[model samples]
Target: MDFPKLNLPPVALRTRMGDRGRTMVWDVLRRRYVTLTAEEWVRQHFVHYLLEACGYPAGLLANEMAVEVGGVRRRCDTVLFAREAARPRLIVEYKAPQVPITQEVFNQIQSYNSVLKVDYLIVSNGLQHYCCRMDYAAQQVTFLRGIPRFEELI
Candidate 1:
């Protein structure tokens, strides 16, 4: 299998026998048999990385959740909520590895944030990841080299 260029390490993909005697691999979270799209592939790895490396609680991480903005429905790649508060804290926007990380990606996430009111935003294309903390009060964004660990956020 050809894997996309990612800054993170390769994930362990498992193969299973399909109904038609074809082989299929369980996707991230081992939830379903999905033909791995470039963005899904990156999201799978990143989800595990967040849980293990960053101490983000897997239970608090929501994937492909829908939110409304200006009466328009939009889906977010990933949203991390505070364990105790159950309030959204971080929003992640994922792109296919081949797709460039551009202002449009940020704008899309920002549009979603208008409703979710998350504190931090992350945009990634597997090969590169960008993180920023939103200063809503000041109407500014501060870029960070990486996302803060769960402990730091708490």
Candidate 2:
């Protein structure tokens, strides 16, 4: 796989070539090594950014959490929980750096958020990132300038 360098800040990673002849990166949230594909590369970068730069609480972040949508089971790429396991504070979906973040991507995240009803949503492709703040009362989503700090969320 041609892992392109994205616009996101660089973070040092622990990696190993897997037995299957693929590179793997350590997923701190999931506590395992996953094949370092294009999307996975972006995921690892953004997740690490959330932890090291944004100061997001590690305990609140999870990777590949089970979610039920449209009578089928799906796993969200990453989620930030508030004080409860069922309620997510933020839902994030990642794409490969080459994949453009389009309406379809936004709609996909929205669909996932339908069940989550999270306060915030993020869509990223490593090179670019978008965030929105949800107002259920107003039935509106306000685009944010950037990901809010953990303190700001609290």
Candidate 3:
């Protein structure tokens, strides 16, 4: 798969083809190798951008955390935690580079937000990125130019 340059910073990744030509990518955060699909490629790049370019501590990030949506268990792509550890500050949802970011995608993350109550939401497909600052108390959401730095959330 040809991975395109995204809005995020360049990332140096370690990837290899596995048995039956299954591509695998090294997950520095998880400290393991995972299947390298199109979406995963975007995810890895975003992770590196958060850690290297934006200064988000690896300890404060979680990948594929499980949540309940409409009584159905689902996994969120990534979440940035507040210092409290339990409180999530941001939720990131990623799609394959070729996938179009639609309202359904936003709705899916919003469902996760219904449970997380995060202050920020990001949806990306490597080709495009949408960042939103949520004012839950005011029942409003404002789109941003790009993802904010880790310190900005703090």
Candidate 4:
């Protein structure tokens, strides 16, 4: 499969048959046959991109991580941790290529932030990506055209 450039290293992926005539693939870290949903496809690719092209340490990244909000369960696409902070430094929400990067996506991450309270937020659809730094004390967010490099996090 053709994938976009990422910031991290290459990962081994294998294809296998899935239910309902779907093709499943193994996501190494997640260790599961994730359904080939459009969004999932974008997500899988971006995870590699973040590591191969963005220089994000693979050990510091988490995929398909779960969190709770308002007594309900929710999943975050990716969570990046910084060693110095001893917690998640960024939370990412990924959409299908067809899904537009809109306020709804931002709002979803914001809701997650209410609980996780990460310092940065990233939303992407494989095609376009939006990143921002959160300033909780000031109640503000600053948008960036793309995800910052690994060094920038420091």
Candidate 5:
């Protein structure tokens, strides 16, 4: 598959042929090879950015995390956990490079937040990125100018 160049910094990825010659890319967080779709390509790149560029610990990052919402199980794209508290601090959702980030995407992440209650939420389509800090007490959402470093989140 021909993957488009993303806005994120490029990183080396381990890839291999899977069943029926499908391309599989190694997921560091999941520790397995997952099929490399357009969205997966963006996800892998962003996860690498989070680890190598943003100072987030690998142990504190999770991919395809299960969450319970409205009596249903859903998978969050990426979740960052608090080191000391062991609670979710941030959540990230990814889309294909061609997909535009919209309010529906925000609503989807917000629904997941209902269960995780993370302080930060991020939405990316590889080419564009957005970060929001949720102030539950004030019932306000603050759009961040850029993605914050791991230390800043704490």
Candidate 6:
């Protein structure tokens, strides 16, 4: 299976054919092999971008993180945690390369934010990316010029 070229820096991923001719890729953050869907393809690229280009520590990044929202369990695509406090600092949502990044996409992340209450939010469709810094104190959302480095997040 050929994955679409993402806007993010190219990343090397370990992939293999799984049962029933399914494609699978190794998830370093999860320490397991997961089915390589289109969204997962974008997710893997974004995670590598944060690790290799943005200087985010692998230890602090969690994929498929579960959070309880409105009495239901929802899994966040990726979550960045503070090293010192081990608290969630950022949430990332991924979509297929063909899926347009729209306000509906942002609203999905925002719903997850209501539970995580993270300071940063990111949405990506492999072809395009968006990052926002939420200033709860000021009740404002600032769209960042670009994806921030690990230090900038702190």
TM-score of each: 0.88, 0.95, 0.94, 0.85, 0.98, 0.97
Q: Residue-wise lDDT of candidate 5 within 9-87, one digit each (tens)? A: 9989999999989999999999999999999999999999999999999999999999999999999999999998899
State the lDDT of candidate 4 residue by residue for 8-104, as single tens digits. Answer: 2345657777777777877756777887777777777778777778888888888878889889999988999887765888999998777888999
- Sort the candidates on lDDT, descending order: 5, 6, 2, 3, 1, 4
Question: Tens digit of lDDT per residue, candidate 1, span 1-154?
Answer: 4666588767686666777775566655436775566777788778877887898987888888889888888889999998779889999999988999999999999999988888899998888899999888899989987878988873
User: What tens digits encode model 2's per-residue C-alpha lDDT throughout 15-87?
Assistant: 9999989898999988899999889999999999999889898888999988899998998999999865557
lDDT (C-alpha, whole model) for all candidates: 0.83, 0.90, 0.90, 0.81, 0.95, 0.93
Candidate 4 residue 134 C-alpha distance from true site, Å: 0.8
Top candidate by TM-score: 5
Candidate 6 lDDT, 9-123, residue by residue in tens: 8888999999889999999999999999999999999999999999999999999999988899999999999888988999999999999999999999999999889999999
Question: Which rank order by TM-score, best down to worst?
Answer: 5, 6, 2, 3, 1, 4
Clashes of 1: 0
Query: In model 3, what lDDT does residue 148 have?
Result: 88
**How much is 47 displaced in model 6, in angstroms?**
0.5
Q: Which number leads on lDDT?
A: 5
- Give the runs in model 2 whose Cα sits over 4 Å from its true position: 84-86
Which has the better TM-score: candidate 2, or candidate 4? 2
Model 1 ranges with Cα > 4 A deviation = 15-30
RMSD of 3: 1.3
Task: Let me know the TM-score candidate 5 reaches against the reference structure.
Answer: 0.98
TM-score of predicted structure 6: 0.97
Global fold similarity of model 1 (TM-score): 0.88
For the record, the alpha-carbon RMSD of candidate 2 to the native fold, in angstroms, is: 1.3
Candidate 5 ranges beyond 4 A from true positions: none
Better candidate number, 3 or 6, judged by lDDT: 6
